[model samples]
Target: MAKRQVQTTKIDGKRVRIVTTTGANGTRVQVTEAEPKEWELQAAQVRALRGMPEYGKQFLLAGDQNSAKRGPRAQMEASAAGMTPGEADMRIYIAGGQLRMIENKVGRGRLSPAQVDRHAALARMGFTVDVLRAVTTEDAAHQAVALVRGWLAENDNQSGQGQPRCSSTACA
Candidate 1:
Protein backbone atom coordinates (compact mmCIF):
# COMPACT_ATOMS: atom_id res chain seq x y z
CA MET A 1 0.00 0.00 0.00
CA ALA A 2 1.10 3.57 -0.67
CA LYS A 3 0.32 6.80 1.10
CA ARG A 4 -2.14 8.78 -0.94
CA GLN A 5 -1.39 12.01 0.91
CA VAL A 6 2.21 12.71 0.06
CA GLN A 7 2.95 14.70 -3.09
CA THR A 8 6.48 14.64 -4.46
CA THR A 9 6.93 16.37 -7.79
CA LYS A 10 4.69 17.72 -10.51
CA ILE A 11 4.79 16.46 -14.07
CA ASP A 12 2.93 18.09 -16.90
CA GLY A 13 0.17 19.78 -14.89
CA LYS A 14 -0.33 17.29 -12.04
CA ARG A 15 1.67 16.64 -8.93
CA VAL A 16 3.15 13.13 -8.52
CA ARG A 17 3.41 11.16 -5.31
CA ILE A 18 6.29 8.83 -4.59
CA VAL A 19 6.13 6.03 -2.06
CA THR A 20 8.58 3.59 -0.66
CA THR A 21 7.97 0.28 1.09
CA THR A 22 10.44 -2.02 2.80
CA GLY A 23 10.15 -5.81 2.81
CA ALA A 24 12.40 -8.84 3.10
CA ASN A 25 13.85 -7.97 -0.32
CA GLY A 26 15.35 -4.76 1.09
CA THR A 27 13.64 -1.57 -0.14
CA ARG A 28 11.17 -0.92 -2.91
CA VAL A 29 9.99 2.40 -4.23
CA GLN A 30 6.93 3.24 -6.25
CA VAL A 31 5.56 6.34 -7.91
CA THR A 32 1.86 6.96 -7.95
CA GLU A 33 0.30 9.55 -10.23
CA ALA A 34 -3.36 9.19 -9.65
CA GLU A 35 -6.43 11.39 -9.76
CA PRO A 36 -5.70 15.07 -9.22
CA LYS A 37 -7.51 17.12 -6.62
CA GLU A 38 -9.18 20.40 -7.55
CA TRP A 39 -6.50 22.61 -6.01
CA GLU A 40 -3.72 20.60 -7.54
CA LEU A 41 -5.30 20.79 -10.97
CA GLN A 42 -5.87 24.52 -10.59
CA ALA A 43 -2.29 25.03 -9.49
CA ALA A 44 -1.12 23.19 -12.57
CA GLN A 45 -3.15 25.53 -14.71
CA VAL A 46 -1.63 28.57 -13.01
CA ARG A 47 1.87 27.33 -13.76
CA ALA A 48 0.98 26.86 -17.40
CA LEU A 49 -0.55 30.31 -17.66
CA ARG A 50 2.65 31.82 -16.29
CA GLY A 51 4.59 30.34 -19.22
CA MET A 52 3.22 32.87 -21.65
CA PRO A 53 5.58 35.32 -23.32
CA GLU A 54 7.64 37.50 -21.02
CA TYR A 55 7.67 40.49 -23.33
CA GLY A 56 5.76 43.59 -22.18
CA LYS A 57 3.34 41.57 -20.08
CA GLN A 58 2.76 41.15 -16.36
CA PHE A 59 0.98 38.40 -14.46
CA LEU A 60 -1.05 39.05 -11.35
CA LEU A 61 -2.82 36.66 -8.98
CA ALA A 62 -6.57 36.72 -8.65
CA GLY A 63 -9.46 34.62 -7.25
CA ASP A 64 -10.06 33.61 -3.65
CA GLN A 65 -7.93 34.81 -0.82
CA ASN A 66 -5.87 32.37 1.21
CA SER A 67 -7.70 31.24 4.32
CA ALA A 68 -4.48 31.11 6.30
CA LYS A 69 -3.95 34.80 5.67
CA ARG A 70 -7.23 35.72 7.33
CA GLY A 71 -7.87 35.86 11.07
CA PRO A 72 -10.06 33.19 12.65
CA ARG A 73 -12.97 35.60 13.09
CA ALA A 74 -12.42 36.99 9.64
CA GLN A 75 -12.67 33.52 8.15
CA MET A 76 -16.02 32.96 9.87
CA GLU A 77 -17.47 36.22 8.56
CA ALA A 78 -16.00 35.75 5.11
CA SER A 79 -17.73 32.43 4.76
CA ALA A 80 -20.94 33.54 6.43
CA ALA A 81 -21.32 37.00 4.93
CA GLY A 82 -20.51 35.54 1.53
CA MET A 83 -17.47 37.41 0.40
CA THR A 84 -17.56 38.38 -3.24
CA PRO A 85 -15.10 36.24 -5.13
CA GLY A 86 -12.48 38.02 -7.22
CA GLU A 87 -11.62 37.16 -10.80
CA ALA A 88 -10.64 33.60 -11.46
CA ASP A 89 -7.03 32.41 -11.68
CA MET A 90 -5.02 35.32 -13.04
CA ARG A 91 -5.04 38.81 -14.54
CA ILE A 92 -2.52 39.76 -17.15
CA TYR A 93 -1.60 43.27 -18.27
CA ILE A 94 -0.28 43.82 -21.76
CA ALA A 95 1.88 46.68 -23.03
CA GLY A 96 -0.97 49.03 -23.82
CA GLY A 97 -2.58 48.65 -20.37
CA GLN A 98 -5.05 46.10 -21.70
CA LEU A 99 -6.20 43.68 -19.02
CA ARG A 100 -7.56 40.19 -19.56
CA MET A 101 -8.62 37.35 -17.37
CA ILE A 102 -7.55 33.74 -17.89
CA GLU A 103 -8.84 30.67 -16.18
CA ASN A 104 -8.27 26.98 -16.76
CA LYS A 105 -10.98 24.50 -15.99
CA VAL A 106 -11.31 20.75 -16.37
CA GLY A 107 -14.51 19.23 -17.67
CA ARG A 108 -15.67 18.27 -14.19
CA GLY A 109 -15.15 21.70 -12.67
CA ARG A 110 -17.92 24.21 -12.09
CA LEU A 111 -17.77 27.85 -11.09
CA SER A 112 -19.43 28.93 -7.87
CA PRO A 113 -22.18 31.56 -7.85
CA ALA A 114 -19.84 34.26 -6.61
CA GLN A 115 -17.38 33.44 -9.34
CA VAL A 116 -20.12 33.67 -11.94
CA ASP A 117 -21.06 37.10 -10.68
CA ARG A 118 -17.49 38.29 -10.70
CA HIS A 119 -17.02 37.12 -14.27
CA ALA A 120 -20.14 38.96 -15.35
CA ALA A 121 -18.95 42.13 -13.70
CA LEU A 122 -15.57 41.87 -15.38
CA ALA A 123 -17.23 41.37 -18.77
CA ARG A 124 -19.37 44.46 -18.26
CA MET A 125 -16.18 46.38 -17.64
CA GLY A 126 -14.99 45.44 -21.15
CA PHE A 127 -12.56 42.78 -20.04
CA THR A 128 -12.49 39.48 -21.86
CA VAL A 129 -12.43 36.55 -19.53
CA ASP A 130 -11.11 33.46 -21.26
CA VAL A 131 -11.77 30.09 -19.71
CA LEU A 132 -9.61 27.42 -21.28
CA ARG A 133 -10.56 23.75 -21.26
CA ALA A 134 -8.29 20.82 -21.90
CA VAL A 135 -7.78 17.23 -20.85
CA THR A 136 -4.55 18.11 -19.10
CA THR A 137 -2.83 21.15 -17.65
CA GLU A 138 -0.04 20.81 -20.20
CA ASP A 139 -2.51 21.19 -23.02
CA ALA A 140 -4.10 24.17 -21.31
CA ALA A 141 -0.71 25.86 -20.99
CA HIS A 142 -0.20 25.62 -24.74
CA GLN A 143 -3.57 27.27 -25.22
CA ALA A 144 -2.58 30.08 -22.86
CA VAL A 145 0.51 30.77 -24.91
CA ALA A 146 -1.51 30.88 -28.11
CA LEU A 147 -4.01 33.23 -26.48
CA VAL A 148 -1.29 35.68 -25.44
CA ARG A 149 -0.02 35.74 -29.00
CA GLY A 150 -3.50 36.37 -30.34
CA TRP A 151 -4.09 39.23 -27.91
CA LEU A 152 -0.85 40.84 -29.00
CA ALA A 153 -1.81 40.53 -32.63
CA GLU A 154 -5.28 41.89 -31.95
CA ASN A 155 -3.93 45.00 -30.24
CA ASP A 156 -1.45 45.54 -33.03
CA ASN A 157 -4.10 45.19 -35.74
CA GLN A 158 -6.41 47.60 -33.95
CA SER A 159 -3.66 50.18 -33.74
CA GLY A 160 -3.97 51.15 -37.39
CA GLN A 161 -1.82 48.27 -38.57
CA GLY A 162 -3.39 46.38 -41.51
CA GLN A 163 -2.10 43.04 -40.32
CA PRO A 164 0.38 41.73 -37.76
CA ARG A 165 3.89 41.78 -39.12
CA CYS A 166 5.86 38.79 -37.91
CA SER A 167 9.59 39.41 -37.69
CA SER A 168 10.44 35.75 -37.26
CA THR A 169 12.05 33.71 -40.00
CA ALA A 170 9.06 31.38 -39.99
CA CYS A 171 6.87 34.23 -41.19
CA ALA A 172 9.39 35.27 -43.81
Candidate 2:
Protein backbone atom coordinates (compact mmCIF):
# COMPACT_ATOMS: atom_id res chain seq x y z
CA MET A 1 0.00 0.00 0.00
CA ALA A 2 1.19 3.50 -0.75
CA LYS A 3 1.83 5.87 2.13
CA ARG A 4 -0.56 8.79 2.49
CA GLN A 5 0.33 12.40 2.96
CA VAL A 6 -0.47 14.89 5.69
CA GLN A 7 -2.36 18.04 4.84
CA THR A 8 -2.80 21.34 6.62
CA THR A 9 -5.83 23.56 6.15
CA LYS A 10 -6.48 27.06 7.43
CA ILE A 11 -9.36 27.10 9.92
CA ASP A 12 -11.33 29.58 7.84
CA GLY A 13 -9.45 32.62 9.19
CA LYS A 14 -5.88 31.44 9.59
CA ARG A 15 -6.17 31.93 13.31
CA VAL A 16 -4.75 28.52 13.99
CA ARG A 17 -3.86 25.45 11.98
CA ILE A 18 -5.66 22.22 11.20
CA VAL A 19 -3.66 19.20 10.25
CA THR A 20 -5.10 16.06 8.76
CA THR A 21 -3.09 12.90 8.28
CA THR A 22 -4.15 10.33 5.76
CA GLY A 23 -4.03 6.60 6.25
CA ALA A 24 -2.50 4.14 3.78
CA ASN A 25 -5.84 3.96 2.00
CA GLY A 26 -5.72 7.71 1.37
CA THR A 27 -8.55 8.56 3.74
CA ARG A 28 -8.10 10.91 6.64
CA VAL A 29 -7.24 8.95 9.79
CA GLN A 30 -6.78 11.78 12.28
CA VAL A 31 -7.32 15.49 12.66
CA THR A 32 -5.59 17.98 14.94
CA GLU A 33 -6.99 21.35 16.02
CA ALA A 34 -5.25 24.22 17.81
CA GLU A 35 -6.18 27.88 18.34
CA PRO A 36 -4.90 30.80 20.33
CA LYS A 37 -7.28 31.90 23.08
CA GLU A 38 -7.35 35.56 22.13
CA TRP A 39 -8.03 34.93 18.48
CA GLU A 40 -10.50 32.13 19.07
CA LEU A 41 -13.46 34.43 19.61
CA GLN A 42 -12.67 36.47 16.52
CA ALA A 43 -12.35 33.33 14.44
CA ALA A 44 -15.67 32.05 15.74
CA GLN A 45 -17.20 35.44 15.06
CA VAL A 46 -15.76 35.37 11.55
CA ARG A 47 -17.08 31.86 11.09
CA ALA A 48 -20.48 32.97 12.23
CA LEU A 49 -20.05 36.19 10.36
CA ARG A 50 -19.31 34.34 7.13
CA GLY A 51 -22.78 32.89 7.23
CA MET A 52 -24.07 36.34 6.44
CA PRO A 53 -24.26 37.63 2.87
CA GLU A 54 -22.32 40.80 3.55
CA TYR A 55 -19.14 39.09 4.69
CA GLY A 56 -19.31 35.52 3.41
CA LYS A 57 -17.39 35.41 0.16
CA GLN A 58 -14.98 38.12 1.17
CA PHE A 59 -14.10 36.36 4.39
CA LEU A 60 -13.66 33.04 2.65
CA LEU A 61 -11.46 34.50 -0.07
CA ALA A 62 -9.25 36.52 2.25
CA GLY A 63 -6.85 33.54 2.61
CA ASP A 64 -7.01 33.57 6.38
CA GLN A 65 -8.65 30.30 7.18
CA ASN A 66 -6.98 28.71 10.16
CA SER A 67 -7.44 28.16 13.85
CA ALA A 68 -6.85 31.05 16.25
CA LYS A 69 -3.41 31.84 17.70
CA ARG A 70 -2.07 33.32 20.92
CA GLY A 71 -2.70 36.94 21.90
CA PRO A 72 -0.02 39.61 21.45
CA ARG A 73 1.00 39.36 25.08
CA ALA A 74 1.12 35.60 24.95
CA GLN A 75 3.00 35.61 21.67
CA MET A 76 5.53 38.07 23.02
CA GLU A 77 6.03 35.86 26.04
CA ALA A 78 6.35 32.86 23.81
CA SER A 79 9.03 34.70 21.87
CA ALA A 80 10.89 35.41 25.07
CA ALA A 81 10.44 31.74 25.74
CA GLY A 82 11.96 31.18 22.26
CA MET A 83 9.28 30.92 19.57
CA THR A 84 8.54 32.53 16.24
CA PRO A 85 5.71 34.99 15.54
CA GLY A 86 4.11 32.37 13.34
CA GLU A 87 3.84 30.36 16.51
CA ALA A 88 1.79 33.25 17.92
CA ASP A 89 -1.91 33.86 17.69
CA MET A 90 -3.41 34.49 14.29
CA ARG A 91 -4.09 38.21 13.88
CA ILE A 92 -7.58 39.58 13.20
CA TYR A 93 -7.84 41.81 10.15
CA ILE A 94 -10.69 44.24 10.52
CA ALA A 95 -11.73 46.41 7.62
CA GLY A 96 -9.39 49.39 7.13
CA GLY A 97 -7.40 48.52 10.17
CA GLN A 98 -4.16 46.84 11.09
CA LEU A 99 -4.37 43.24 12.21
CA ARG A 100 -5.59 43.32 15.80
CA MET A 101 -5.88 40.98 18.73
CA ILE A 102 -8.84 38.61 18.85
CA GLU A 103 -10.42 36.19 21.26
CA ASN A 104 -12.00 32.82 20.38
CA LYS A 105 -13.37 29.80 22.17
CA VAL A 106 -15.38 26.78 21.06
CA GLY A 107 -18.29 24.82 22.51
CA ARG A 108 -20.93 25.86 25.03
CA GLY A 109 -18.84 27.74 27.52
CA ARG A 110 -20.88 30.03 29.71
CA LEU A 111 -19.29 33.46 29.85
CA SER A 112 -19.50 35.31 33.11
CA PRO A 113 -20.27 39.01 33.29
CA ALA A 114 -16.72 39.70 34.42
CA GLN A 115 -15.46 37.74 31.47
CA VAL A 116 -17.61 39.82 29.16
CA ASP A 117 -16.14 42.95 30.74
CA ARG A 118 -12.68 41.64 30.07
CA HIS A 119 -13.71 40.93 26.53
CA ALA A 120 -14.90 44.51 26.25
CA ALA A 121 -11.50 45.63 27.37
CA LEU A 122 -10.00 43.67 24.54
CA ALA A 123 -12.50 45.25 22.20
CA ARG A 124 -11.37 48.68 23.36
CA MET A 125 -7.92 47.57 22.37
CA GLY A 126 -9.28 46.85 18.88
CA PHE A 127 -9.44 43.12 19.37
CA THR A 128 -12.44 41.22 18.08
CA VAL A 129 -14.03 38.82 20.53
CA ASP A 130 -15.98 35.68 19.67
CA VAL A 131 -17.75 33.10 21.79
CA LEU A 132 -18.77 29.79 20.26
CA ARG A 133 -21.76 27.98 21.63
CA ALA A 134 -23.12 24.54 20.84
CA VAL A 135 -25.95 26.44 19.06
CA THR A 136 -27.71 23.57 17.34
CA THR A 137 -30.14 25.44 15.14
CA GLU A 138 -29.84 27.87 12.27
CA ASP A 139 -32.37 30.01 14.07
CA ALA A 140 -29.95 30.35 16.92
CA ALA A 141 -27.28 31.73 14.64
CA HIS A 142 -29.76 34.08 13.04
CA GLN A 143 -31.00 35.23 16.40
CA ALA A 144 -27.46 35.85 17.54
CA VAL A 145 -26.59 37.92 14.49
CA ALA A 146 -29.74 39.91 14.88
CA LEU A 147 -28.99 40.54 18.51
CA VAL A 148 -25.46 41.66 17.84
CA ARG A 149 -26.45 43.88 14.95
CA GLY A 150 -29.07 45.55 17.04
CA TRP A 151 -26.65 46.01 19.86
CA LEU A 152 -24.03 47.54 17.64
CA ALA A 153 -26.61 49.70 15.94
CA GLU A 154 -28.04 51.00 19.17
CA ASN A 155 -24.61 51.74 20.51
CA ASP A 156 -23.72 53.53 17.35
CA ASN A 157 -26.75 55.74 17.71
CA GLN A 158 -26.14 56.36 21.39
CA SER A 159 -22.70 57.55 20.48
CA GLY A 160 -24.24 59.83 17.82
CA GLN A 161 -25.21 58.15 14.57
CA GLY A 162 -28.71 57.81 13.11
CA GLN A 163 -28.35 54.08 12.60
CA PRO A 164 -31.47 52.32 11.45
CA ARG A 165 -33.15 50.33 14.14
CA CYS A 166 -34.08 46.68 13.72
CA SER A 167 -37.81 46.19 14.06
CA SER A 168 -37.96 42.43 14.04
CA THR A 169 -39.64 40.87 17.05
CA ALA A 170 -36.93 38.24 17.15
CA CYS A 171 -34.51 41.06 17.85
CA ALA A 172 -36.79 43.09 20.12
Candidate 3:
Protein backbone atom coordinates (compact mmCIF):
# COMPACT_ATOMS: atom_id res chain seq x y z
CA MET A 1 0.00 0.00 0.00
CA ALA A 2 1.02 3.58 -0.50
CA LYS A 3 0.22 6.67 1.47
CA ARG A 4 0.37 10.33 0.57
CA GLN A 5 0.53 13.42 2.70
CA VAL A 6 0.77 17.15 2.26
CA GLN A 7 3.04 19.07 4.57
CA THR A 8 4.76 22.39 4.90
CA THR A 9 8.39 22.75 5.90
CA LYS A 10 11.46 24.89 5.50
CA ILE A 11 13.86 24.47 2.62
CA ASP A 12 16.92 26.63 2.44
CA GLY A 13 15.31 29.11 4.80
CA LYS A 14 12.08 29.33 2.82
CA ARG A 15 8.83 27.74 3.87
CA VAL A 16 7.39 25.46 1.22
CA ARG A 17 4.47 23.11 0.99
CA ILE A 18 5.33 19.63 -0.25
CA VAL A 19 3.51 16.44 -0.91
CA THR A 20 5.21 13.21 0.07
CA THR A 21 4.55 9.59 -0.74
CA THR A 22 5.34 6.51 1.28
CA GLY A 23 5.48 3.01 -0.13
CA ALA A 24 3.89 -0.16 1.18
CA ASN A 25 6.98 -0.87 3.21
CA GLY A 26 6.44 2.37 5.09
CA THR A 27 9.56 3.80 3.52
CA ARG A 28 9.41 7.31 2.20
CA VAL A 29 9.59 7.24 -1.56
CA GLN A 30 9.59 11.01 -1.90
CA VAL A 31 10.86 13.51 0.61
CA THR A 32 9.87 17.13 0.66
CA GLU A 33 8.79 17.27 -2.95
CA ALA A 34 8.39 21.00 -3.07
CA GLU A 35 6.77 22.24 -6.24
CA PRO A 36 8.55 25.46 -6.96
CA LYS A 37 6.89 27.89 -9.31
CA GLU A 38 8.05 27.70 -12.94
CA TRP A 39 9.57 31.16 -12.81
CA GLU A 40 11.39 30.36 -9.60
CA LEU A 41 12.87 27.22 -11.07
CA GLN A 42 13.93 29.08 -14.19
CA ALA A 43 15.55 31.82 -12.19
CA ALA A 44 17.43 29.29 -10.11
CA GLN A 45 18.62 27.57 -13.26
CA VAL A 46 19.82 30.89 -14.69
CA ARG A 47 21.72 31.60 -11.52
CA ALA A 48 23.45 28.27 -11.84
CA LEU A 49 24.40 28.89 -15.44
CA ARG A 50 25.59 32.44 -14.80
CA GLY A 51 27.75 31.35 -11.90
CA MET A 52 29.54 28.93 -14.22
CA PRO A 53 30.36 31.28 -17.07
CA GLU A 54 32.99 28.83 -18.32
CA TYR A 55 30.32 26.21 -18.84
CA GLY A 56 27.10 28.11 -19.56
CA LYS A 57 25.70 31.62 -19.72
CA GLN A 58 22.34 32.83 -18.43
CA PHE A 59 19.37 31.50 -20.37
CA LEU A 60 18.54 33.65 -23.35
CA LEU A 61 15.11 35.27 -22.94
CA ALA A 62 14.45 35.16 -26.69
CA GLY A 63 14.85 31.40 -26.71
CA ASP A 64 12.97 30.69 -23.51
CA GLN A 65 9.38 29.63 -24.12
CA ASN A 66 8.53 30.14 -20.49
CA SER A 67 9.75 33.69 -20.49
CA ALA A 68 7.90 34.60 -23.65
CA LYS A 69 4.60 33.93 -21.90
CA ARG A 70 5.11 37.16 -19.92
CA GLY A 71 5.67 39.34 -22.99
CA PRO A 72 3.00 41.34 -24.80
CA ARG A 73 0.76 39.23 -27.06
CA ALA A 74 2.29 36.17 -25.45
CA GLN A 75 -0.03 33.59 -26.88
CA MET A 76 0.23 33.36 -30.66
CA GLU A 77 -3.27 31.89 -31.20
CA ALA A 78 -3.14 29.40 -34.09
CA SER A 79 -0.24 31.14 -35.76
CA ALA A 80 2.36 29.12 -33.79
CA ALA A 81 0.58 25.79 -33.63
CA GLY A 82 2.59 23.96 -36.26
CA MET A 83 5.52 22.95 -34.04
CA THR A 84 3.56 21.46 -31.17
CA PRO A 85 4.27 23.33 -27.93
CA GLY A 86 6.96 25.73 -26.78
CA GLU A 87 10.69 25.07 -27.13
CA ALA A 88 13.08 23.96 -24.46
CA ASP A 89 14.45 26.42 -21.92
CA MET A 90 18.09 26.26 -22.88
CA ARG A 91 19.95 25.49 -26.10
CA ILE A 92 23.29 24.55 -24.61
CA TYR A 93 26.20 24.77 -27.05
CA ILE A 94 28.56 21.97 -26.23
CA ALA A 95 32.25 22.62 -26.54
CA GLY A 96 32.51 19.48 -28.65
CA GLY A 97 30.40 21.27 -31.29
CA GLN A 98 27.18 19.50 -30.42
CA LEU A 99 23.92 21.07 -29.22
CA ARG A 100 21.59 19.79 -26.49
CA MET A 101 18.33 21.33 -25.47
CA ILE A 102 17.30 21.25 -21.82
CA GLU A 103 13.89 21.60 -20.21
CA ASN A 104 14.07 22.39 -16.54
CA LYS A 105 11.66 20.89 -14.02
CA VAL A 106 11.70 20.98 -10.27
CA GLY A 107 10.33 18.32 -7.94
CA ARG A 108 7.89 16.10 -9.84
CA GLY A 109 7.11 18.47 -12.68
CA ARG A 110 6.49 17.10 -16.16
CA LEU A 111 6.17 18.32 -19.72
CA SER A 112 2.81 19.02 -21.27
CA PRO A 113 1.35 16.78 -23.97
CA ALA A 114 2.22 19.18 -26.77
CA GLN A 115 5.74 19.52 -25.45
CA VAL A 116 6.08 15.75 -25.47
CA ASP A 117 4.96 15.62 -29.07
CA ARG A 118 7.38 18.38 -29.95
CA HIS A 119 10.16 16.49 -28.25
CA ALA A 120 9.41 13.49 -30.43
CA ALA A 121 9.48 15.70 -33.51
CA LEU A 122 12.80 17.19 -32.48
CA ALA A 123 14.22 13.72 -31.94
CA ARG A 124 13.14 12.78 -35.44
CA MET A 125 14.98 15.86 -36.65
CA GLY A 126 18.17 14.62 -34.94
CA PHE A 127 17.96 17.09 -32.10
CA THR A 128 18.96 16.06 -28.60
CA VAL A 129 16.24 17.18 -26.23
CA ASP A 130 16.47 16.27 -22.56
CA VAL A 131 14.67 17.29 -19.40
CA LEU A 132 16.85 18.24 -16.46
CA ARG A 133 15.03 17.70 -13.17
CA ALA A 134 16.19 19.02 -9.85
CA VAL A 135 15.22 17.44 -6.55
CA THR A 136 14.57 20.74 -4.82
CA THR A 137 14.68 24.42 -5.58
CA GLU A 138 17.34 24.95 -2.93
CA ASP A 139 19.69 22.65 -4.81
CA ALA A 140 18.55 23.45 -8.33
CA ALA A 141 21.65 25.51 -8.99
CA HIS A 142 23.91 22.72 -7.85
CA GLN A 143 22.06 20.21 -10.00
CA ALA A 144 22.13 22.46 -13.06
CA VAL A 145 25.83 23.11 -12.58
CA ALA A 146 26.41 19.40 -12.44
CA LEU A 147 24.60 18.98 -15.75
CA VAL A 148 26.68 21.65 -17.51
CA ARG A 149 29.84 20.36 -15.91
CA GLY A 150 29.09 16.94 -17.30
CA TRP A 151 28.48 18.43 -20.70
CA LEU A 152 31.74 20.37 -20.59
CA ALA A 153 33.79 17.36 -19.52
CA GLU A 154 32.38 15.38 -22.39
CA ASN A 155 34.36 15.61 -25.64
CA ASP A 156 32.66 12.85 -27.56
CA ASN A 157 30.54 13.83 -30.53
CA GLN A 158 29.24 10.38 -31.25
CA SER A 159 26.28 10.35 -28.85
CA GLY A 160 24.62 12.74 -26.44
CA GLN A 161 23.61 10.03 -23.95
CA GLY A 162 27.20 9.08 -23.12
CA GLN A 163 27.72 12.14 -20.98
CA PRO A 164 30.97 12.41 -19.04
CA ARG A 165 30.85 12.49 -15.28
CA CYS A 166 32.15 15.70 -13.75
CA SER A 167 31.75 14.13 -10.31
CA SER A 168 30.09 11.24 -8.56
CA THR A 169 26.57 12.59 -9.03
CA ALA A 170 24.93 13.18 -12.44
CA CYS A 171 21.85 15.33 -12.98
CA ALA A 172 18.51 13.59 -13.33
Q: Which rank order by lDDT, best down to worst?
A: 3, 1, 2
Which regions in candidate 1 have their CA more than 4 angstroms from the true location? 1-54, 57-86, 160-172
In order of appearance, the predictions have TM-scores of: 0.55, 0.29, 0.58
After aligning candidate 2 to the native by TM-score, how far in Å is the CA of 100 from where it should be?
A: 11
lDDT scores of the candidates, listed in order: 0.62, 0.44, 0.63
RMSD of each: 9.8, 12.9, 10.4
- The segments of candidate 2 whose C-alpha lies over 4 angstroms from its true place after superposition are 1-105, 109-132, 135-140, 162-172
**Per-residue lDDT for 13 in model 1?**
72
Between 1 and 2, whose lDDT is larger?
1
Best by lDDT: 3
Please write out the lDDT profile of model 2 over residues 91-124, one tens digit for every residue: 3333222233322234544555655665577678
In model 3, the runs with Cα more than 4 Å from the true position are 1-34, 53-63, 67-73, 77-84, 156-172
User: Cα miss at 86, model 2 (Å)?
Assistant: 16
| Colliding residue pairs in candidate 3 | none
In terms of lDDT, the poorest run of 10 residues in model 1 is: 59-68
